[model samples]
Every structure is written in C-alpha cells, then in structure tokens.
Target: MICALTGVFPVTQARAQQAPLPEGARIVVPGHGWGHGRGMGQWGAKGLADQGKTYTQILSTYYPGTTLGARASTEDIRVLLETSSDVIASSDQPFTARWSNNSIIATSDATYRYFKETWDGTNYHGGSIHVYRGAIEAHQGGSSINSINVLTMQQYLYGVVPRESPASWPAEELKAQAVAARTYAARRKDSSRAAGSSYDICVTTSCQSYGGYGTKSSPTSSVTVLESSSTNSALDATAGKVLMYNGSPILAEYSSSTGGYTAASSLPYQKAVPDPTDSVSPHHDWTASMTVSEIEARWPSIGRLIDLTVTQRNGYGGWGGRVLQMNIIGTKGTTTLTGYGFMNAFAWPGRSNGLQGNWFTPLYWRGVLQSAPSAVTMYAGESKTISVRITNTGTASWPVGGNVHLATNSASSFATSTWISSTRPASVARNATDPTKSSVGPGQVAEFHVPLSAANMPPGNYSQRFALIADNQSVTSLAFTVGIQVLVPWVSEAPNLLTNASFEPSTYAWR
Candidate 1:
C-alpha cells in the first residue's frame, strides 16, 4: 500500500492569500471511491429501497430492458401434457424417465413402441422414430428415458425498450462513430506488443460472481449464451459512452462491472468479470487511456498534471503486439506525482476465452525519500557506539521484513573483524506496526543502536554504511562515519625517531 511521491509542495498561506487559481491550471481532487461507477451499484441498490422501489423494479431499472427469466435448468418447467387422452391406455405401465448421473434412458419397451407407433406415418422430420431412437444411445449407462419437451426453466423477463430519441443521429451514424473510436483506441498501442496474455470468458454463476441480495429463496435469471465476436463491441451507445470535454465522442470501453484496479496483478478468477452479453463482431479491439483534458475535467480539483512517459515495446510472444509503458506524472497543478500506465495487446485468434486478454497491470507508483546512518567510525582499540533512525514521509509506508546491514571499512585493510552481537543487528527488535520495522509506517520511525570495540586497534578514521535488504529490493540509510583519532609522535629525524608508544592522551603516538 506504500506509494512514492514525485515532488510535492504544500499550499502555503501566501499562495492561498495571493490569488485565485491561475487560468488553465488544474486542481485534482483526490477522489475517494472505488471501481468504475457502473451497473447495479451496491450502494445505489440499497438506496433504491429507501426510495420505495421494489427489488423487481431495482433489477429492471439497472438492467435496462432486461427481463426476469427462470434458470436454464430446473424441474418446474417439465410438463405432462396429454392432447388426446383416449389415444393411449396405460393400465399396466408407469410413466417415468429413468436417468443415470450422465444421461436419461427409456426403460419400458412399450414406451419406445408407443412413441414409435405414434410417430409412424406422421410428418416427423422426414424419418422414422424407431430409426432415430436406434441412432441415439439407449441404456448404455445405468438408466433409461422417455424424453419430453421441457421449456428451459430459465427465462429472462425483459422489459420493453422505451422509444428512442427522435432527433438523435441515425443508427448507422452511431455505429460508424463507435467503430471509428474503437479502431483508433486499438491502434494507439505504439511500440509495446501484447503476447503471452491470458483470456477469461465469464458467463453464468461459474465465472461471474453472483451475490443475490441476501434473499434466502434462490432466484433465477436467464442464462446468457456466449457468441464469439470478431472484435470488441460497445456496451452502450447512448448511456455509458465516454465523452470528450467538448460535445464529441471518445472511445469508451464499457463493462458490466469493474472489480477494481490495484498495483498487483489479480489471479485468474479473482478479478471482476464484465457482462458477457456484448458482441464485438462490428467493433475493433481497444486500449485504455486518459487525456490531459480528461484528467483535469474528471478531477477538477487537481489542475493540469505533468507527466514523464516511458514507452516500452515489450510483449510476450513477439512484436506486432501490445505495448507496455509507465508515465510518471505530477498530481495536477501541484508537484506531488503518481504513475499511469497499462499493458495492451491486439486481439488474436482464440484469444478471448480467458482472463489474460486484457491485463489490468496498471500502476499508481510514487517515489519516496529514504535516509539512514552509515557505519560507526571509531579508533581501533577504542570503543565506538552508533545509532540510526529511519523515517517515512512518503504517501506509502516503507517495506517491512527487510534486512538491515551494518558494514565498516578500515584503513589498515583489516580483513578480520568480529561483531559482538550474537545475532544479525536487524532482527533484534520488533515493531507492532511492522515486525521487520523496514516498513516504517507513514509518519513513523524506527531506531537501532550498535556498539563497536576496536582492541589494540590501528589509528585511523573509518567509514561505515547501514543498509536494509528485503529479497531483491533494498534501501540503505545514509552513512554514519566515526573519526577515530589516534595519538602518535611525529619523528623529526632518524635520531629523533621513537620506538615506544606515547602515553599522553593528546600526543600523537605510533608503533
């Protein structure tokens, strides 16, 4: 959850008292909400009840012309219709369709004979019923069956579409505009290529998550049939379309829902799945983007955000695919920053069947300032003590569970050194907020102290640096240097040379 910030300056009293916002500058308000505001808003659904709307009305309104239908497979729709009761007598027969777990089979030979006799000499598919039954498997498993016409239990009770606007553009114009927008959106992927992407098809309750408003009675809706579309299709032309600042059209991708966006990639079934009823046969694949104007208009509080774009021609399979890039941008007119980026790929054959087709690997990255004390500098044979405090002022917290390193460099090129602490210096302390203490909470700090004793040590100034290491990620604190000043006598000449060490504290002595 920790995020870095680019450059941020607080709005001071002077700026506030100076003047109104400069023209053309944008102020982006950090909107506190999740997901793309779309169909069946959970909060909105609850609000419907407050407004005195029934559950039926709520579903109908959100679905817009979709009807309530029974579930596709169920027992309620089976029938025993008898058009002519006198035509058949079953005094010694029981009417039943036996079935194994796999399939159903007809047990009674009389039942088969009756069906065959009934269909004989009739206009039944230009073939005999006996011949047809012979072609079909019977009693292969542990069951028999007499098939009956069963209305699919599932039914979508669709509401009639209201009349369209009389003055709106004709259907053809709308379609063309949508197509153009989609085509343009798809082509915007410059150097990046899309390869090794996965795809997911969400339909029914299997792939799409279904939460029935806490109703105990299991409800059913019409089963949505999947149709392979050659390309992407617009979810809504009049309602959910993304519009430009002007009264113009913008390429918009509509989903039944947006699970949410996060810094880490989501698992196969963990992400939110879109409504599967859309058809892409007419439109082209598209990418996601945000214009400067769009950002300003959408986030009116944050004025024109500045951004540094890094475009990558990276794809899994090879070139002529999706592109990947990261754009570091300042938040609005102010200097605080964040990253905006996405990886997109072209639609290839058999690519629309899984979650990999559209990777939501978007990042909202930021930079943070880190500081630490280097190694403790002390005179050889002298005792030295050092301490460090790590703080975080960034939008996010520092990483937790990282290693803390304490290193020292000696002037004598001394290869042998022993640390008194039995364990690694980093693992001695624990924090409630972060056990590792590496992830110092935002506005939080951690401190550590280390003692070094140089016995019979050489006289010299030594430097040391402390570092934090977590797996492949690491951040080192500033270096803490200790100047070990040793007293040694200065020899004027060969006759004045001193072989014994000077005992005075202030005198410079040497061996």
Candidate 2:
C-alpha cells in the first residue's frame, strides 16, 4: 500500500518488505488516541471502566467538584445551535432542563443520570440521561421520565440556562456547576489553543470514528472533541486562514465505529460552496445538444422544426439539492428558439470520481385544446363533425377534482357554449401522488367533440390555429391547422344570346 502527494511518494509498504523505521522512530504514538486528554478520553475511558471506575466518578473527575441535582420546571425555549435551519419546540428548566445561553449549567441525581438537554436562551430543559457503571448500565431512562434531568456531554459543552427545579435544588445548586464546567472547555475555538482543541465531523463516514464495542455507550466513554474549535484552527493555519486542499478547503471528517466517514469543508455559511464531492456541486462545465433531427423525428408532418442546444459551465443549482435549469437554443437556418429544462447524468464533469449525477426535467403540465370547431376540412359550406383528441404529456399529472377547459374562438361562446362538457374530474379518481393537476404523464390523452363551422369560414385556402394550455403543469401553444378551399362556379352561353351559369358543390377542394 502507498500514499503520495504531487507525484512524491510518502507512505509505502510492501507485503513482504521489512519494517523501515529506526529502533526509536515511531510514525504514530503507541497510545491509542489522536486527540485531547480531558473529558471522555474514549479509548482511555474504556480502559478505565475495564479497571472498574463508575460513571458517577467519571463525571466528577472530568468536571471536578460539581453537584448533581434534578431538572427545573418546564417552559418553551427557542434554541439556535450551529446556525442550523431547523427549529425544535423545546422547554427550559432551572435545575434539570437545557437552554441556550452563553453560560449556564445544571445537574441531576446519580440514580437518574442518563439525560439530554436542549435550550433556546431563557430556560434550561433536560431529558432522560444515559450513563453506564461498569459492564452494567448505571442509569437507563428508557421510556421513563423518572430519570434525572442531567446535561449530556454536548449540553454541558454548549452551555445551559438554569432555573428553579420543580423542587428546590437545596443542597449543591446543579446549574452553577454545569456552567463552570462548560466555560472551562469553551475557549477551545481560539486559534491560540489549536494544540488543545479538536474538530468533530458530522456523525457519518465523513468524520472520525469512535471504535467502541456494542450498542450501550458510557456517557463518559463517548465524549469527543467539539468541531468548532478544530475546524477553525485548520482554517486559520491555511495560507490566508482560508484553508485549501487542491484549491479548496480541506473537509474535516468524523467516523462512527459502525462504518464509513463523513466530511465538512471549512467554508463560511454565507456564500459557501458545496462539498466538491457533493452531487449538487459543479466540478466542471459541459455542453449538451438536442439535435434538430431528434425533435422533428419525434413528430413529423410539421414543416417548421426547432431544436435547442445548451452550453453550461457546470450542472449545479436549484432547491432540494438539484441541478440548475439549463437554457436550450434551437436554430434552423434563420429561425431560432429557446427553452429551459434540466438533465440527469451518471457522473459530473472534470474528475472521474465515481459519483453519479441524477438529473431530470422539473414537472410539466398538460395542455388543453380549444377552438371554434372540433374538426375542419378543405371544403366551402359542408358541415362536418370531428373529434379533437388532446393529450396531457406534462411531467406531472392533471387534477382529479378540477375541470379541464375547452374554449371556442367566438367571444360569445363562453355564454352560449354552456352545453360543452367541461365538468370537474371525479375526485375519487385523483392520483395519490398529487392532489392538484400539477402533473400530466406522457401520452395520456383526452378528447373533445366539436362542431365544424362551414358557413362563416370562406373556404379559399384558409387556416386557423388551436391553442392548448395545461391547467397547472406548464403552458403550451399548440396550433391544429386544417386548410380549407371553396370551389368556383362555371358559366356558359345559352340559346337566345342569354348567359346561364351553374354552380356544383364538390367534396374535395384543391388548393
């Protein structure tokens, strides 16, 4: 196995090669830790518990001289942690609850130690605490609320607001002790304390892992260095404190004993670029073409065909972590057209890192057809009936409880064409995916019967356009063109010098 940088070899070892380090040269410390020496030492904690140190003693040793008590009363607290977008409805307690404060603390009884606390600003609210003794659990709240409302390692670090418990914390005020412990470890974010601080990654393969055994965890055994401090230091040490790795911030990682790693780059919340490997980020720019033949071939008989080709720097944009809309341009000789849509791919541009980019067009609506006549023919005054078939080909389906519309070119048709069938679709038949007719699947067809108007249309090579607009999916302009022509009469000379003419109707009108 080998690791390299800039074509320069660094770490390498052959399966049968002799170890190369000198007698005293150690690449890594023999001790089983790569982080701070305080609080929950992880590996060290396991070792300690193996030697039989109780969890209560473990907490006391880390916090030093602190009292454990019950949670205070319950009142809602507005919590804002890590600048996250989610807001959870929570409460605060003076002794037992958790709260969001620059500084505060509280504790619970040893018997009910397993606890979790979250706070907004005002009060400290707490939940069941989970702690371990030796191989056995000292406190397992399970579904019971009887457990003490003590702060977990996280709550203790973030700081909690303390208030009066339902019963007075008469003996040793739990809140004050929690605050003192929090402040002790709070300044680790300062650059000057890099040696003492550590970074914590999101709880995934993107981060460092805690290689502990089994499901039950000792509260003291699982403590880890906070992310804020470590990430900031790495960022500060970078050329301009703007950490970079191959021209981008080096993402920090945290691993759970379970599997894989999770990572987070050192970018500010404002205008921060997405992780390079993120499916939503743009690694390179590329262009795609939808050929003219492709569209024309899809539907023939239309003389004018337009095709659009798009060129984009990269495929990254949109909400719900999707690609940006791509603008397409179609040009046929002197005619040009433009449209917007998206694309899906198995990978991104630039690198060959095996990440798949699944892109597709957003939802489209079905268009309805409306015209004066249902059908038309190339004739002068011959009344004919034709059925107009319309299809909803939008990416989305149509509404079940809403009416599909059909209109005639006549301005007074709205009042006179009340007899036209434009009833709301049956609600029972609505698709479960969408209640609104916001989507219309491809090839789903709808039809309407219309009467052809032959009297007003002067059949002399005339044509009219029918338009269709989808209810909620998308708006489309459809032209159903039918050509019509009127036949001319023939005149002949009769006896007595009088001119007689006769007109004969023909079924076919030649243009």
- Most lDDT-accurate candidate: 1
Residue 482 C-alpha lDDT in model 1 = 38
- The lDDT for every candidate, in the order shown, is 0.29, 0.28
Model 2 gets an lDDT of 0.28
Per-candidate TM equals 0.28, 0.25
Off by over 4 Å in 2: 1-361, 366-385, 390-393, 398-440, 444-448, 451-462, 484-511
Please, what are the lDDT tens digits per residue for candidate 2 over residues 1-511?
Answer: 1111121112111122111112111111001112211222222222333446643443343333334332221211111111223222222222333333423234443245567777786552333223211111112223322112222333322222121111122112222222222222222222213553122111211222211111223323453322233222222222121112233322211111100001112222112122211221121222222323333443344323322212221122221222222322222232222111222221222323222222222232333333334223434445454555555533334443344344433332112333233431211133333335443344455554434455444435555444443332223434355444444332333433323545467563332
Regions more than 4 Å wrong, model 1 = 1-385, 399-401, 404-424, 427-439, 451-456, 466-471, 475-480, 485-511
Question: For candidate 1, lDDT tens digit of each residue in 398-485?
Answer: 4433343333423223212433222334421333336645455544554544555566556665544333322222222234443444
Candidate 1 lDDT trough over 10 residues, lowest sum: 156-165
Q: Identify the candidate with maximal TM-score.
A: 1
User: How well does candidate 2 match the true structure in TM-score terms?
Assistant: 0.25
